[model samples]
Structure formats: C-alpha cells, structure tokens
Target: MTSNSTTYEGGCTCRQVRYRMTAKPLFVHCCHCRWCQRETGTAFALNAMIEADRVELLSGEPEPVMTPSASGRGQKIWRCPTCRIAVWSNYGSAGDAVRFVRVGSLDEPDRLPPDIHIFTSSKQPWVVLPEGAPAVTEYYDTKKTWPAESLARREALRAKRS
Candidate 1:
C-alpha cells in the first residue's frame, strides 16, 4: 500500500495536460488481449485501476474519444488534445466512476507494477511474464482476486447504482 503522502503525477507527451493521483491504485493490470494490442500499438497495455474521484486535473483538459472494445459496450479514452496521448479510459462497466489509467503516462511508470496479467491466451509468445505474478488466460473473478478494500469499494458503488 502506498502512503497517504505518496502522490503520483503524470501528463501527456506534449505536456499539454497534467493530472495527479491522490492515492495508490486499487489494482494494476497488464492486458495482452488483441484489442489492447491494436489500441495501444504495443504488446500489452498496462493500466492502473483507480476511482475517478482520485484523479485530479492539474492543467489542460483531456478530450474523451469513444473507441470500440472487446466488451462491445466500448470505452471512452481520455486523451490530450494537442499531443493525442491517451491518459486514461472509462469502460462501460463503471462508466466514469472508475478510470483505467495508462501507466506509461505516469511520471514514475515503474512505481506501480502490474498486479495481474490478463488475456494471456492471445499474448505474444516472446513476452515473458514475471515469475509468480498472477496471470490468467482471461479476466479473473473479482471476488477471487480483488483486495478486500477494493471489493468493499465496489460494493459501495453498486449500492449507489441501486
């Protein structure tokens, strides 16, 4: 767990937009799905999942671009207008309540490592996962994988939905 004083700052490539994370991410995911590869133009997409309330804008506003996803509901990618760098995404499941932050956009990308690797069935053969890291062929059950606090937080969100 990150200390309360520990904050993360990040911005777009052109530095047109800036944001801050007040707390540690609830979880980080290294997704190797084909859709992720096509969107990121890379082997995988490293995303740090956090509540939208935790992300505070410090500078320029990012534009949300709707993009197709494997889930069919699509996702809204928040990107810097000038640099066109994707800072984060809001999936349909949680809408804007949660943000899937692009870890690569972080000032200290190495600070938060992937808590789990998903969609490994389609992963490139050469990309090796770290030993002992939690990995699965597809998405895992949140009840079985997510931390207790995260589950509780999700429950609270669900309660609000109802």
Candidate 2:
C-alpha cells in the first residue's frame, strides 16, 4: 500500500504538458476492453484513478478532447497539444470529480501497478495476467473491492460535491 504522502510527476512525450499527483491514487485499473485497446493502440490502458483536485498541472495545459466511450455517454481525454499524447481522462459517470491518470505517462510507471483488471472478457488472448492479480470479466463493486481508506476518500469527495 502506498502512503498518503506519496507523489508522482509525469508529462507528455513532448514534455509540453507536465503534471504531478500529490497523493496516491484511489485505485489503479488495467482496462482490457476493446475500446481501450483501440484508443491506446495497445492490449490495455492502465490508469490511476484519483480525485481531480489531487492532480496538479505543472506546465503546459492539455486540451480536452471529447471521445466516444463504451458507455455511449462519452469521455474527455486530456492530451498534449504538441504531441497529442493522452495524459488522463475524465469519464462521464464521474464527471470532473475524478481523473483517470494514465499510468504510462508517469515518470516511474512501474511504481503504480494495476490494483485490478477490468473488462478482461475482451482482453487480448496473447496477454497473460499475473498469478495473484485481481481481475474480473467486467467491473467490480467499489464497496467490496476498494480499500477502506480509498472508500473514505471517495466519500469525502462526494460530500464536498454535495
């Protein structure tokens, strides 16, 4: 488990849009849905889900690009204007309350591994998950899967929005 003080800094490939995560993310997801694979052009998209307030932009601004999503509600993918590298995404369900930071964009991407793998039903046949990694065909209930601290943090954020 990561400490609350843990911080991470990252940027786009061109270094035009730098940012920092002030604390550990609420959760990390490795999504293997077809939409993710096509969007990222990879087997999966690894994201660190955290409160939007925790992400601090340190450099150039990222332009939000509206994109179609599996939910059909769509999502906003923040990408660097220079390199057009996706840095993060704000899903329609969570709106602006949360940001799914791209794990691959981090300076030390390996530090935050996926807490769980979702949409594994559509995962590429060639990709193999770790022995003990938490995974599900679709999604998991946050109440049952999320750590207590993360749940509390999410509740606090919700309270603020009220």
Candidate 3:
C-alpha cells in the first residue's frame, strides 16, 4: 500500500524464478471465494492486479499451467517450473492483457495490501474483514472502485480492442 519504489521484485520459493514489476499495481484484491480458498489452501488469496506488459521476467521462465476456476472458461497460472510456486494468473476476462499477481509471491508482499475484499459471500465463517475496509459480496465495478489513472489505462486498453 505504501512503498517508495515504483518497481518491485519477486520470485518463486527457491528464488530460481525472478521477475520485476515496472510500475505499481492498479489494484489489489483479497479474494475469499471458494475457488480461491481451494486453490490457495487458505482462507483467502491476495492478488495484485496489473497490466501484464508491466511484468518483466528477470530470470527463470514460468510455465503457464491451465487450471479450472469458478468461471467455466478457466485460467492460466504462471508458476515456477521447478518450485511449482504460482506467481501470477491470467483469467478469462482479460486473457493475457492483465495479470493477477500473487502478493504472497512478492519479496515484500506487505508493500501492497488488499485495496478491496471480494467474494465475501462465500468467505469462511471464521474470517473477519478489517473494520471500514472496502468489501463486496461479489466482484466490483472497476470503474467505481479503481483509481482514476487505472480506469483511464483500462479504457485505453479497451479502445485498442475495438
């Protein structure tokens, strides 16, 4: 949430796969959906959303593994081939244009905390969201929640598709 550097570096558990983000993330999500719980083997998943183009591989290449998701279309999780640690994922909605980077995979994960908590309808009963934190029962409208700069960036990307 608070960092002096625009760029951030991270990699797999073994440190074999390294990558850098050229810019700060557009947004961060604390997802509590059942699918996320199952995939992460935890109560929730912390993901930093950003444009895929901004992610640069500094060392090892990640293998994109096809995986099932709440959406039938599925997603591709880019993981370190050797350590098998998932670094990021490309969902069906944005394809490869956007990446949901696993904050846990970051060297300084604390630098980017969840901007919003999503899919709380299916969240575990034991889990309690922070007081006054932005949360929603399901996915949010990016136009309403995303920062102005991020919204403009997204709009520009959409314009290119047209």
Candidate 4:
C-alpha cells in the first residue's frame, strides 16, 4: 500500500465482523441491479472493490448466505449473524477470487464514493446518478474493473495526489 492510500477500518453493525483494508480500493460503485435491491433492502448497493489480499479479517467470521447471480452463478454473501448485516460477497467461479465488500457496512463509510453506477437499466426513476460518474445500463464492465497491476498503479497515483 502507498503512503497516501487510506487504510479503511470497518465492521458489521454489531462490530462482530471487523475488517481492515490497507490499500485504496480498486473501484467504488453503486449497483442498481434487482438482486442488489432485494439483498440490500434498498434501491441500490454501495460496493468497494479491493484486492482480496489487502483486506484482513480483524474479528469474527461472517455467516454465509448463498444466492444465485444473474449469470446463473452462485454468490456467497457473508454477513454478521448478530446484526444480520451483509458485509461481503464472493463470486462462485473458482477462476475469480475477489470479494465485494459492502461499503455502507464500514466503520468509516465516507472514505470512498461510488465512482460508477452500474445496472442503470434497473435503477429507480427517482434516483439520479451523480454527474460525471461512469454509468452503465447493463451487466459486466471494464472501466471500473480492477486488475492487480492497475490497482497498484492507482494506489501510487492516489499517493502522489494526496
């Protein structure tokens, strides 16, 4: 992690599932997919994509909730059983090893902002995406996707900017 890159500390509602991410996020996003809406019990879900290795579990283990994805894949949502708050999710494919952390569940939720708005086609009409954000009407994207090297580069850039 770069010096200027912020270290984020967060946990579930009851603080039973604490976590720390040493590096800056790969990307932040507001997803408006139907699954997100049902799962989050909100119009959308705020997510911070980060390298799996950089995230450390500081406390209790999260209970897993398995659900089907839009692509017919399985998604395992990890949550704090005490608070029943979804903290992170793992995509089913063995080839993909990243976990999507729920940004809102963090201790410092404001450390990051949604840089992109995804699944806009399912977005609620009343909710307008912030101006200048990258918006997509469908599933799967590249602009907000993070590769390891790119993530490291972004961390460096963040340090320089800070």
* Candidate with maximal lDDT: 2
Q: Write one digit per residue (lDDT tens) for candidate 1, span 1-162.
A: 233445888989999999998877888999999999999999999999988888999999999999999889999999999989999999998788889999999988999899999999999999999899999999999899999988887887777778
- TM-score top scorer: 2
Per-model lDDT:
0.91, 0.95, 0.91, 0.78
TM-score of each: 0.94, 0.96, 0.95, 0.82
lDDT (Cα, tens digit) per residue for candidate 4, span 1-162: 123447888888788889888777777778999988988889998988765777899999989888888778888888898988888887765212466889987777877888778899999999977787778897555534656665676566456555
Candidate with more favorable, higher lDDT: 2 or 4: 2
Task: Report the lDDT tens digits of candidate 3 across residue range 39-124.
Answer: 88999999998898899999999999998987898989999999999999999988898899999999899888899999999989
Model 1 spans with C-alpha error above 4 angstroms: 1-5
RMSD of each: 2.1, 2.3, 2.0, 6.2
Q: Native-vs-model 1 lDDT?
A: 0.91
Clash count list over all predictions? 0, 0, 1, 1
| Global fold similarity of model 2 (TM-score) | 0.96
**Model 4 CA lDDT for position 145:** 65
Worst 10 contiguous positions by lDDT, candidate 2:
1-10
TM-score of model 3 vs. true structure: 0.95
Per-residue alpha-carbon lDDT of model 2 for 1-162, expressed as tens digits? 123448998989999999999999999999999999999999999999999999999999999999999899899999999999999999999999899999999988999999999999999999999999999999999999999999999999999999
